[model samples]
Target chain A: MNAQADLNTTVPVELIDEFLKRIPYVSEGITNVRLLDGAQRVMFDLRPGFENQRDLVASRISEIADKLCLNYRPGSSRVLVKREALPGSYRQDPHAELQQRGDIIAFGRGRYGFGPKLVRLIEFFEQRSREMAASFQADPYNFPALIGADVLDTCRYLKNFPASLNLVSHLREDHSVLQEFSQSVRWDGEQLAYDRNGASGVECLLSPSVCFHWYRWLRDVELKEPRAITALGKCFRYESSNLTGLERLWDFTMREIVFVGPAEYVLASRDRLVDLSARFLDELGMAYEISTATDPFFVDSYAVQAAYQQGFELKFELLAPLPYSGKKLAVGSINYHQDFFGRSFAIQAAGAPAHTGCLGFGYERLALAFLAQHGLDQKQWPAALDAAITASAAHDKA
Target chain B: MTSSPNESIEQRIAGAVMRALKIADPGSSTPLRMGSTPGWDSMGHMMVVMELEKEFNTRFPPYLLPQLVDVEAIAKTLRKPA
Candidate 1:
C-alpha cells in the first residue's frame, strides 16, 4: 500500500477511527486521539503503559495513514485535543470611557492596548505574583501566550471548554491555492466560506490559562517536595455573551502561582494561598467576598464531579462588583485540580500521580475594579494602593 | 420485590428522589424537573439514579443519566415493562 493512490484520502476523523481500532490495545493503550485536519495534527490520550510510547504509536499511525494516501505528515501528530470553533471575527472597538481616560486603547471588543496607568497596575500585579511565589521559593517564568493546540487537547481543554476557545490561523501563503479555494465558496453577503479549506490547520491557540503552559512545561518531572512556580502571560478566552470590560474579556493578562506535589501539600498550599489572597485584597481595601463557584468545566459527563466540587466548595472566588456593569465579579480564584493535571501530563509525585493547585488573578479586571471603585484618579486611591502606584510610577520615571 | 401497590412505589421513589437531592417539602407535587430543580444538580441526579436502582433492585443505563430528569421521568422509567 502506497500513499500515491491520490492526494485525497479519507476524512481525518474516519481515517483516525479506522486506525484507532488497529492499535495494539485500543481501549487500554489509547485514551483518545482527536484528529484536527485528519493529517496535520491530533491529540492522543495515552493509557498507563504507553505513556512513554507516544512516538511509536504516532509513527505507526502516520505510516499506515501514508500508505493509505491520506497525506499524512510524518511526525506531525501532537498530543492535544481541540475541535472546530465558532467563527469569531468581530469589529467592535473598546469601551469609550477607557479610551478617553487613556487607560487602554480599544483594538476590538475584549482586546485592549494598555496605557501607562494600566501598565503600571499590571506590573504591580506581576510584582505581587513574584512576592507570592518567592515566599515559597518558587521559580519565576514567562511563558508564551500562544500554546500548541495539541497541548490544549492533551489537557482535555478541548473536551471541557471548547465553547470559549479561539483558534489562531493564517492565510495560505500560496496565492493560487488560496484564490481557487476562496472562489469556490460564494459570499452571498451573509455566508462565509470560513471553510478552512484554504487556511492552515490551526497550529497554535491563544492560551486560556497560565497554568496550562506551566503544567505542560512541568510534564513528567519528578518532584519530592512541593514545587512552586510563578508565571505571567497574556491569556485569551472568547467571551460570548459575557464579553464586557475587564469583568469578562477576550484578551487579558494573568499571573498565577502554581504548586505541584503530593496531595496533602498541594491542598495545604492552596488553603494558604487562599489566605494569602484574602490578606492581599484586604490590604488593597478591595471589598470582596470569598464564595464557592458553581459553574466548572469538569466536562459534561462529569456533572456529578462538578456538583461535588460545588457541594464541597473546592472552588472559591473573590467576588467584587464590576463597576461599569454593576455585576458582581470573581476577581480571583483558588483551585485544587487534585491530580487532574498530573494524569494528563504523566507527572508523578512520590511514585503516584501528583496533585496540583493554582491561584489565578485577573490583573486587568483588578485594575478596572480599582478604577471603578476608586474613581479613575490615582490621587483618591486608597492610601496603601495609592502609595504603591506612586512608587511604581516614580521608579519608572527615574 | 412486590410493593403494597403502584401508588406506594411511586410515592416511595418520589420521596427518595427528593430526599437524595436535599430538596425539602417532598410532599409538594412540584413535578421535579431536571436542570431546574433547586438541588437536582448533576450530582443529585446521579444520587437519585443510584437510589432508584437500589430501591427497585434495577440498574439504569449510563446514557439515561440525562433522561432521568424529573420524578415523573424516573417513575415512568421504573414502570416500564421489564
Candidate 2:
C-alpha cells in the first residue's frame, strides 16, 4: 500500500534542501520523501507495511524541524575550480551499462560484486591515489574492516553519527550458547531467526572511514616529526533509504591519506593535496568542483554541527557532475580535524597535541562519475587513464 | 558557590565551564583546555557553550564555536560586542 502525507509544519526555505535529504531517514517507514507547496510543506511516501506509522514519522520530522536552527543561511558554496566537459562528451547511464556488460553484479541494495572492468577501474583510481600519496612520502598501511567501538566512542563518532553505525557481534563464547545458536539458527525468507540471548555484546563496529584507524594506531604516542599514512579500506555507513546505485553505498572503498604533526605541517599538507588533486582531476579531463561541505551529523545535532563545520570551513568536497540527473556526486573530501583527534588520542607533536587532516577519495563514486561523464567505452576515456588501464591489464597477464 | 554579579567575564566563563563539566573550580590561574580538562570532550564543549550562552544572554555565532575551546577563548568571545 502506498501512502503520502503532507507535513503540517512550515520548514524554513533556507533549510528545505537539507530537510528533504533527512526526511527519508526519519523512519524505516519513510521510503521516499519530497518537498511541496514551494518548500513550505513536505510529502512522505510510506512503505507498504508502514502506512500506519505515518503519524509517528511526522512527529519525528517535526521534532527535528523544530530544533533546526534558523540562524544558518546556506553558505555561498565556494567553487575553487570548475571544469567544462571535454568536447564530444556526453553522459551515459553507467549503472545500466556496467550491469549489462557484467562489470558489476548487485548482491543487494547498496552492495555490488565487481567484475574485471569495474575492478580494473577501482584499481586504477587506487594507483592514482597511491602516486599522490607517494609524492608526500606517505607510507602505505592496511587497516581492518572492524574497529573497536570504544575507539569510536573516544572519537565522538558515536555521538555525531549514531545513525550510520553498524555494530558487529558474535555468538557468546560459551558451549551452551554456541550449541543453542547453531541448533536454532535458521534462515527465513526475510532474515535469520536465531537465539538473540546467545549473542555476545558488541565490541566492534564496521569502520565508518579508513582514517580513524590511523589515529587509533598513534594513540598516546609523541611524534618528533610529522608523518603521513595512506590506506585503502572498506568503510560502512547505514545510509537507510538514501542508499542507491554506486553513488551511495552501505559499504564503499575509501582511499585516504592522513597527515599528523604540528598544526602548520598538517594544514600545509592538506592544502598541498587539495591543489594536487584538482590538477589530477583536470588531467583526467573530468569536469568537477571543489567546494565547502559539512558532514551529515544526526538530525538532532545537525543544525549546530553543520553550522560549526561550515563556519570554520573544516571540510571541502570534490563534486563531479552526474549529467543524466543534473546532480553532483561528492567523489572526494579534504578534512581538517585540527587538534580534535590529536587531543582525543593523546598524540602530541611540537610540545602540543598534534593537528591532523586527511583526504579521502570514494573509489566507486569516482569510477561511476568517470564512466557517466566519458561514457563506458574504454577507447573514449582520457589518454592517460586509458593508457594506465591498458598497462594495468598487461600487468595482470604477466 | 553561585556566580555573583561581581564576577569578571573570565570568572563567569570559568564558572560556566566548571558547571558544564561538573568539576570543582581549579582557581582562576589554572587554564582549562577542551581535551586536557576532565569531561571536556566534544559533547562537553557543546555543554560549555550552552552554559555560557545562557549566562551571557547571547547566541554565539557559529564561526566562533570552534575557537571557544578554553575559558579564555570563551571569555574573549563573550566580551566582544554582540
Candidate 1 residue lDDT tens string, A116-218: 8878767776677778888878888889878999889988787766667889887678887677876786776735665566687799998998998878887
lDDT of 2 by residue, A324-344 (tens): 788889999999987889989
In order, candidate lDDTs are 0.66, 0.83
Q: Write down the C-alpha DockQ for each prediction.
A: 0.03, 0.29
TM-score of 2: 0.87
Q: Candidate 2: where are CA atoms >4 Å away? A: A1-9, A48-51, A70-74, A84-88, B1-61, B64-82
Best by DockQ: 2
Clashes in candidate 2: how many?
0
State which candidate has the highest lDDT: 2
TM-score of 1: 0.61
As a whole number from 0 to 100, the lDDT of residue B27 in candidate 2 is 64
